[model samples]
Target: MHDKYASVVKILHSEASDLMSLAILSGRDPFRFYNGADLTSLDLTNQNLTGLNFDGADLRFAHLEGASFDKGSLNRSVLDAAQLHLKDGFEFNYQDVLQFPGKEILMFCMIRSSLIDEILIDFGINYSVFAEFSKISTGALRKARVGKVIAIETAQLIFNGVFRFSKTLDSKIGMKCINSIEQPCAKMLVGGNNKPFVEISAEDVHRLFEIRRRRIAHMKRERGTNASPYVDYRDTAEYLMFYKHLVDDIDFWTKFDEESA
Candidate 1:
């Protein structure tokens, strides 16, 4: 019952749909405080909704065509058959990989690196800047607790996470790296239209990965550190786009989705 409009809504029906309609007519979003509210087969097609909380609510067979799907709580709402335009980063969840495994999360990384490279290039970042991103991403992959077994699904999640990290660095840490290179290493880097870059061959990046892989292989940490020459720059930059809110599915009135989540 609406505390503010209970008197006005007294004449209205008490069913979920009737209450939902009253709530809408009362100029408030529909909210079911019970996260487990079963809202199966509600004719919610193409309706602009607000104040709707669907956290853990069952929306199976709900008609949601052309309506924004991110406006409610869907912590674990059944959303398989809903007609919605979902984006990749959303991945059909509240901007998280909460249900996906580490392997599946990592799978997205296979193409993530390349996409990052292209975008950086588009932004006029050069080899030095690119190398910094590469180093950061590659090293992070090694230290990630996602287990040694990387699969497509897991990689995608990891890759998306790393992609977000790079964006963050671009604003925070990338500037420092760019400044340092422009000062002392300007001559060694390739020059973009508006940025300078370092000389990093594909082989160099590959070597970095190889080093990270074998760093902990067949040896003790002390011995490895003493004899091995692998360098990891995980702290320099981090990936954070995966399991994050990329876009869409923004249930603002519900606990199902989170902007920071």
Candidate 2:
């Protein structure tokens, strides 16, 4: 573990300058620093990140297999490509108790797919159909919309789900899936309201499915190696089940089609 820590520290220190701008050094004392930094693509495998408050940090592509975060705070941290595993008979808690502060929040609790789908339809902010799933010439579309750009909040939700369950899938496939979801979501928010109605490309949609594939791979691995049954990340499954909710929100805003001032 010491060796692992050394490697992680070296990488962080060397690249600290570049990352400092992206790092969130908030609060004070035990929970008073670095709440939501972006530490993506760093190798922190098998190190002890226990009790660290990474409450909204982007830890995508970080190697954390067998790492100890037993009591660490990752409330809203992004773990898209991170690897996690339990140590000798140790049980890891995967509960998402972190409160993400925002208005356009997207919550996905574990439940049946049908129920999730219904909930998404009820809360979505856009009216655009998931073009990838249905034909462009489908029946009449719904007119409900939310008229606000909530992509950032929604993206974080998606990232959290990918990170929490990434370790279960094949590394390559998992990374691809995470990138698929994270990229467009990030892009949508870059210009904010200026590009509110930006369409997600076909490539991006494919990436979402890739996430599903990787999830299945992870489930199979857990069942075959650990004797545990296949369990998908309830959060992610729920989000996908009710993704249309976000679509509704976007569509509503587009109906007005007023440019951002």
Candidate 3:
């Protein structure tokens, strides 16, 4: 695979004066270890990029229509103004190893609340939460005896109540809360100023999950007693959106590490 890629890279470099334009017609599917390479503004329509590692590469303004990125690592790669349209069953594994360049702010906008929660919880990071209808504050709510508040972002909320602690120490207390449903609640510490923290109750998470379950149940009932194609496709798309950010974040962090090293 390495030899094939080396040949393609040489061809891409020698054939065309414009390297970006050369990559557009390189006919190199599944390029191996293509890192920090500039392929900006290339047209990669209907390309099969399965298992491609675009770590620390620039793909700005590239055309990726109908591209298959199943199991690809796009860590810390730039996709600014790039067109992306994937088919069904696109699998992507993204973590903190990816990064987004040229449009860092826009990349954050694409991240989902569930993905953020997964990343933070896996890393054992502390987060603050408030009511479902309220906001999260790091200062004022530290004094409240509410249930577990895991993490609070602008769009989504997470909580788990499985433990508790006294509110006496000079530092903030981390604990859990158990509701009548026998579910675990999460309370955590977050960053912010003296603003009031909106606490999302443990019941809210259960209720939201329950609502989603019922919605899917109803769809299955209407579509068929066995399965609903639309629900499956929708769920797949939602999952893809979450994975995209993970890949982007991983790429960003990897680049940071290299630069610092």
Q: Per-model C-alpha lDDT, please?
A: 0.37, 0.37, 0.36
Q: What's each prediction's TM-score?
A: 0.27, 0.25, 0.26
Q: What TM-score, to 2 decimals, does candidate 3 have?
A: 0.26
lDDT for model 1, on a 0 to 1 scale?
0.37
Writing each residue's lDDT as its tens digit, candidate 1 over 1-261 gives: 558877356536445443346555555434544246676778777765433445556777777665543322343355554333232221122122223333211212222123334335444655445445445444444433322332334344443444444456656454332222111110011113333222322232333334334443433454656544433323100121221233232342122112122
RMSD of each: 18.2, 20.6, 21.7
lDDT of 2 by residue, 1-261 (tens): 566466445555553432222222211333324456667877776666643456566777876666665232443466663233221111111222123222322222211113213323333322233211222211211211121333333434433544444444666545434333221122221123223343232233343445445555655666776534433433232234334332334543333234322
Candidate 3 residues 1-261, lDDT tens each?
586687676664575543333444465533334557787888777676643556557887777777655322443365673333221111212111022121111111122223334323433535453321134454423322232332223212122221111122122222111111011112212112342332222232233334445556666777785665555432311222233332323543343334333
lDDT of 3 at 76: 37
lDDT of 3 at 41: 81
Give residue 61's error in model 1 in angstroms: 0.6
Clash count, candidate 1: 40
Model 3 residue runs over 4 Å out of place are 1-32, 82-261
lDDT measured at residue 111 in model 3 versus the true structure, 0 to 100: 22
